[model samples]
Target: MENKYQFETERLGFRQWKEEDKIPFAKMNANTKVMKYFPNILSREQSDEFDS
Candidate 1:
């Protein structure tokens, strides 16, 4: 797939979210270490909705 990035740097790029992001995004959202600053961990459904 071609990535049409809105912004880019030498090592990073920003682009629109894809369907493939859901699972991993949910995993990250459920990680206590990752969500330490946030209120709480997200359920898979909540994560999917947040991605939408």
Candidate 2:
């Protein structure tokens, strides 16, 4: 069956966001280098809110 949550290739896969993704997403958002172009890194609450 086709998976609505996923898109894949030979070496890579992307999927719909899940609750599990929040932690990692928050961590990535917390990175200063990554947020450098933005005004500031987002808080977990803010990230989760924006993510939805």
Candidate 3:
């Protein structure tokens, strides 16, 4: 039988997190404007550890 569950996107693909996404995720966290509401911008290490 074919799989019953599937996920799709228009411009991007979706999948479980992998080790490769660490850098981009960290960049987002390190961005001051993105984190303006928070007390401070996240460090690379912090961003690496943070979950979506």
TM-score for candidate 3: 0.59
* Ranking of models by TM-score: 1, 2, 3
Tens-place lDDT digits, model 3, residues 1-52: 9544355668765566778889888887889889889998888888876555
What value does the lDDT take at residue 16 in candidate 2?
A: 74
- Which residue segments of model 3 deviate by more than 4 Å? 1-14
Q: lDDT (0-100) at residue 18 of candidate 3?
A: 73
Per-model TM against the reference: 0.77, 0.70, 0.59
Error of 3 at 2 (Å): 9.0
The TM-score of predicted model 1 comes to 0.77
Runs of candidate 2 exceeding 4 Å displacement: 5-14
Tens-digit lDDT track of model 1 for 1-52: 9669989999999988899999999999999999999999999999999756
Worst 10 residues of 1 by lDDT: 43-52
> What digit string (tens of lDDT, one per residue) describes model 2 on residues 1-52?
8876467898888877889989998998889999999999988988888657
In Å, residue 11's CA in model 2 sits off its true spot by 8.2
